[model samples]
Target: MSADTVAAPRLSLNVRYNRNVQENSGEEEESQVEILEDEEHHADLRPQRARPHTQNNPAANNRRCFKATAVALGGFYLLMLAGLFIRFTLLQTRYDQLSNNNSQLQDEVKKLKDRTEVFKSCPHGWTGFGHSWYFKSEEKKNWYDSRADCQQRGADLVVINNKEEQEFVSELSKDGESWIGLWYEWTQGGWKWEWVDGSLLTEKFWAAGLPHYNGYYAACCIQQGKWTQGYYSDNKNWICEKMII
Candidate 1:
């Protein structure tokens, strides 16, 4: 009541202390805006570092394309086992050249079948059928009875003319049979062949129908058919003549 009421109480206590300081600054700016919105919501919940794993990824390029297709299938199975070892060494060198050409064609077919069986048992220049000369026989003979008593010794009984004179009369009849010249006479009527220098019957190596005179008998001469086809009474196997020196 005396100096203005003591300065109105000290300005009303300084206006209530500036209104409490502006209401504590406004509650500290609203707690700093809720702490900046919780630090932007924890920076959007974390975790991001995983992107560094690359290798151009599509599952790491499909595991490097399956290890380059298993090394190109092991180099194509080692080139098919070296082409089956060069086709089994060219089939064992063509089976040893066809077994040496079949053993040289079986030794040339066994020497051409032994020269065709020695030209079918002797045969070359044989003659008879006429009259050369005398060839008679009455034996005390024994050289195969003087060669079958010379077939009664006559005109055309021994004539195997070739294979080198039938191996030279089978080596001179080996141990027996001899007298050889040839005879047979009775002329013109039919049986005629004499050759021992007297020459007559022109040259007839008969085999077919031979000196036929069946009944009249004088069939003197001509023998050797145990393998060529000729016969008179069958037994005499002679005839290996050769004269032209």
Candidate 2:
């Protein structure tokens, strides 16, 4: 054996070992790349998780709307009821006042009826008429004082009922103006003529352009078969009447 021949075999063995190591490393790299690609494909095919969501309830929303509408309607009805109550209260007060006035007038009529039972015929100086007695005053006085005089004599200012009575009273006062029972009074429809017994005038016998006085200070007077209005404070003659029983 020669030293050169031994060295050549050792070099050939080293070259074979290096080639095998490079081939093993290349195989390992290819295996690792295939494994990574498989893992990515499996991850893409996996199931997805669901997201959170919010829901709405239509019935609950309608109920809330209905409650709000009911509350508003109830408030409107309450306001109407309050207004009606106030109106009723005011009407009741007015009715009570009218009732009291009516009662007072009825008492006065009753007293006059009682007085009628006492006089059977016309008095000594009074003139006789249908179912009543009449008296004409000679002196002049205001309407209030004239009424006072008649009341003292158990009579009142004359209230002419019909055309005949109207004519008779007018003839009786042919001399000058005389106050009658008719006077302007306060009523629901404003000032109007009413008799002393609290009765409204039904028949009228006004003069030409007469009965035209204004305000509550007016009274009726007879002049030549016609009626006229004058101030209640005017000095004038008056007629009185007492009912016969």
User: Candidate 2 at 200: error in angstroms?
Assistant: 0.6
C-alpha lDDT of all candidate models, in order: 0.45, 0.78
For model 1 the TM-score comes to 0.23
| Residues 46-67, model 1: lDDT tens digits | 4333344433678767888887
**All candidates: TM-score:** 0.23, 0.48
Candidate 2: where are CA atoms >4 Å away? 1-121, 216-224
For each predicted model, how many residue pairs clash, with residues at least 3 apart or on different chains? Answer: 22, 0
Which ten contiguous residues of candidate 2 have the minimum total lDDT? 47-56
